[model samples]
Target: MASIKQREDGVWRARYRDEVGKEHARHFALRRDAQRWLDEVAAAVVTGQYVDPKAGRITWDEWTREWMERQSWAMGTHEAAAVAVQSVPWREGQISSVKSSHVQAWVAGESKRGLAASTIKTRLNYIQMSFRAAVADRVIATNPALGVKAPRSRRAEAAMRILTAEEVREALDAADEFRGFVEVCVFAGLRLGEAAGLQLRDVNFLGRSITVARQVQGSTIKAARIVAPKYESERTVYVPDELMTSLAAHVTRAQVTAPDEQLFVTPLGRLWNRNNAAGEWRRVRKDARLPDEVTLHTLRHTFASNLIAQGCDVVTVQRALGHSTPSITLNVYSHLWPSAEDKTRSATASFMGEIRDSADSVRTETEKPQVRGSRYR
Candidate 1:
């Protein structure tokens, strides 16, 4: 059946039933638009190029459940993707009938809603990727979320606070029972989950390198759930000899002889989380008189800064911090690197010094020019 009608809300509605007996309908502000939409649907029905328009009407909650079931990905990535999608405007809306204008409006709306541009960018990526999948599944003709304009959020170049060697010593002293865990975080640049997930077999005492392959899953009170590292975070980071000795002692004291045994844990022997970091963080923050803004992640920034300050290359620091690329490391810590002007100045000065040395050699040869002249003559 085909019909067009004007409703009390001053809108035109068009309805059609496909050959499969599936009904599709849409509303428009004008009878012309309704007629046009119906004509397009009629043409599609005739040539058999039409997909079920009603398929796009599935609620986001329903589609998400189905889409999630189809995805086999790392837990961390799945969580990230889920968070990114749920943050969007259409999270609870029908997935069909979404348009490029809707996505653009969402980007602008998110910016006005106090979301950072970087966060908006991430959310936009998730939607675009999802719509792309919808296209492949014949759920939509095009990805409505692609090529949208979003706000650009560039972080300030201000450097993070780095503990001096003396401060590090005091912080370690304040850690007391949790000192071993703090040591690895500050020295090895592991994320909190990675630190919590540290196992006996991952530490290579002979090589002084720690292999990071997995991270602790979140919010479990029972058996520790291990998952692949975040964002291609698997890497081998070498520790200094001083930290190596501490790790050796830590292993010995923890009685970790088994490969799967966790090297660091709460006093109760359970894995650590933000809520259960114990008084170790509190005591260290208090006794050390550290800045209130400094959290465990600050130790990571400190480690990266220390590495760059000591002339470690960005790639090495990127691997150590488990960043997906060196560009990320550079983006976050580029200000700490030697300025291009400084490098140019140093290079020019070295070249001038070499030129002066050559000039001196020529001066001596000029005095001996008569000798060479005689010999060649």
Candidate 2:
């Protein structure tokens, strides 16, 4: 229900009862202005787009706090989300008022602050998600950040490195005490943290399978917490007999008999964290004389690339890498699928060749040897 009335004070008042019967009102200088406001409100209600005027009054800071509490995030994702939301430029203002211009300005500000393009893009994604949720909750009519563009991250793409067969061997030999750790990453495609969280129980030596159940979620030994794999990508990766034998030898060498004991650990038997793992990786890279651009994660890329080289399909590569979806696998490693264009040409040539062969075989005898052949003569 809605109404527009002129009071004795010469003010035009517009009033409406919302879907829940809560009343809202505003006073305007002109009767036409009050009527126009009522019409807009009625349209919004009929279109199922009605948002209570006061609902958007909550600030971005307050909304994000409530939103974060309701999300079920892994430890690492929660930390990243915390950092991302806190980094937004206008936390104190009403979230509904944030416009696309504000989001663009924030992107520009992040660039000026010397943040990496990828980092700025990630932060922008979080801001977009927040506004999208706000729109869904009826706290805002639209997502202001939906159309905002983020700066492109070119450096990371340019630096992607895939190793060859010999390079993989050299890197493994140079890994020294970390050989088994590097092997699992290169052969099984485990992320650094996933390999760190690997336990004896997760390995099926006879079956040559390793189950990815959890990951170490922090950089420091003291702060490290075991959590489910990223994006719930818990899965089993099958290994070659050679790699399985290597893991068996590693167990014997490390004397890790207990099923719960971590297969890969520091000399102090502590779980490997990124910081410590990076230091060792540097030594391995330098000793192996590999390109400086090759990081530990590159080994996982190499594994994926090798799978593509072996003619594995997208789902096979995605499952091997524990990617949440085949689209993500393609997004990251589509270049490695060498058969896309090749298969097109080959398929066309194969069918055309069959047509040509059929025509040649069925040709009339008159078209065959006109020269002196015994049968033709």
Cα RMSDs, all models: 6.6, 5.9
Candidate 1 lDDT over residue span 264-295, tens digit each: 88878888864466346877889988877678
TM-score for all predictions?
A: 0.74, 0.80
Worst 10 residues of 1 by lDDT: 368-377
Top-scoring candidate (lDDT): 2
Once fitted onto the true fold, the runs of candidate 1 whose alpha carbons sit more than 4 angstroms away are: 1-35, 42-51, 88-91, 97-117, 141-144, 149-151, 159-167, 220-224, 274-283, 352-377
Assess candidate 2 and give its lDDT. 0.88
What does candidate 2's lDDT look like per residue over 150-250, in tens digits? 88777534656888889988998898889999999999999999999999999999999999998998878888878888885899999999999999999
Model 2 clash pairs are none
Off by over 4 Å in 2: 5-9, 111-121, 153-159, 165-170, 286-292, 344-377
Global fold similarity of model 2 (TM-score)? 0.80
- Span of 10 residues, lowest total lDDT, candidate 2: 151-160
